[model samples]
Target: MTISTEMLWLIIGCAIVTWLPRILPFIFVRALTLPDVVLRWLGYIPVCILSALVFESLLDTSGPIVSFHWSKVLTFVPTLAVALLTKSLSLTVITGVVVMALVRFML
Candidate 1:
């Protein structure tokens, strides 16, 4: 595929736009020593984000009453246990994927 000058510039512009927002925050934050309160609060961000993502995935939003998939709930049990017992991201993810795959297959 031949890319024209305009397409190349468009690609460059998009890259800069995407990269700046992600990188700029780290660049600014890295230099400053955040206070203990801020640091403690920042720690909750990942768990909050993860919970949001998991709930969004497990719930069927057809009617907006928050219908949850039983299979996902079942899958979450072992995954959460693995996360708590092992305290490992990789193992937890692997367990989740395997459990979900098995649950889907069985269903």
Candidate 2:
């Protein structure tokens, strides 16, 4: 229940380590002007990251071979529909979570 002095120091050290990487980018880029192409390319980062995460999560790889989860696939249906129709991240995430929870509870 009580944190020792050493543990406190460890926590402070971890905080500084985590904070530096996040803050350094802003400090270094504040005055810099990136090119238009670079800026345009950076716009796709979110979509690419999301696609990678979604595909990885949908296909499970706990064993030697990659396997697809029907629960996730089924949940993705309504989630994708909502995302495409509304184009809202919040709604899509909520729909996915609700569908997955229902699928898990029912099956």
Candidate 3:
């Protein structure tokens, strides 16, 4: 089947987008050696970023204020505690959802 020009452009775009990030890390990492501490910290980057984003998103009951709506606070506190205590993603999420739902429905 003959592909249209749009399809060709899309394929090229996908290839470039996929390659850019992959090539960048290789180029930069090879050009300069990162410190051991930097590398160690880099490992936690995804976790740190995810935690900050989740906390930021969840904290807003009605904008960014220190308000305890109970459900949101209940949900996230146990969630983070379980995650840190158990170091298990599945347990953390399951516990959080269950607690949140129970609190919401119960109250």
Q: Top model by lDDT, which number?
A: 1
lDDT of each: 0.94, 0.93, 0.85
RMSD of each: 3.7, 2.7, 5.5
For model 3, residues 1-107, the per-residue Cα lDDT tens digits are 79999999999999999999979998889889899999999999998998888776666568576654557876778888998999998998899889988989988
Candidate 2 residue-wise lDDT, 26-98, digit = tens: 8977789988998899999999998999899899888798999879999999999999999998999899899
Worst 10 residues of 1 by lDDT: 57-66
Off by over 4 Å in 2: 4-14
Q: Candidate 2: lDDT of 36?
A: 96
Give the CA lDDT, 0 to 100, for residue 56 in model 2.
90
- Which ten-residue region of model 3 has the weakest summed lDDT? 60-69
Q: Which stretches in model 1 have alpha-carbon errors above 4 Å?
A: 1-17, 30-37
TM-scores, all candidates, are 0.64, 0.72, 0.52
Greater lDDT among 1 and 3 belongs to 1
Which ten residues in a row are the worst by lDDT in model 2? 25-34
With a 3 Å backbone cut-off (N, CA, C), the pairs that clash in candidate 2 are: none
Full ranking by TM-score: 2, 1, 3
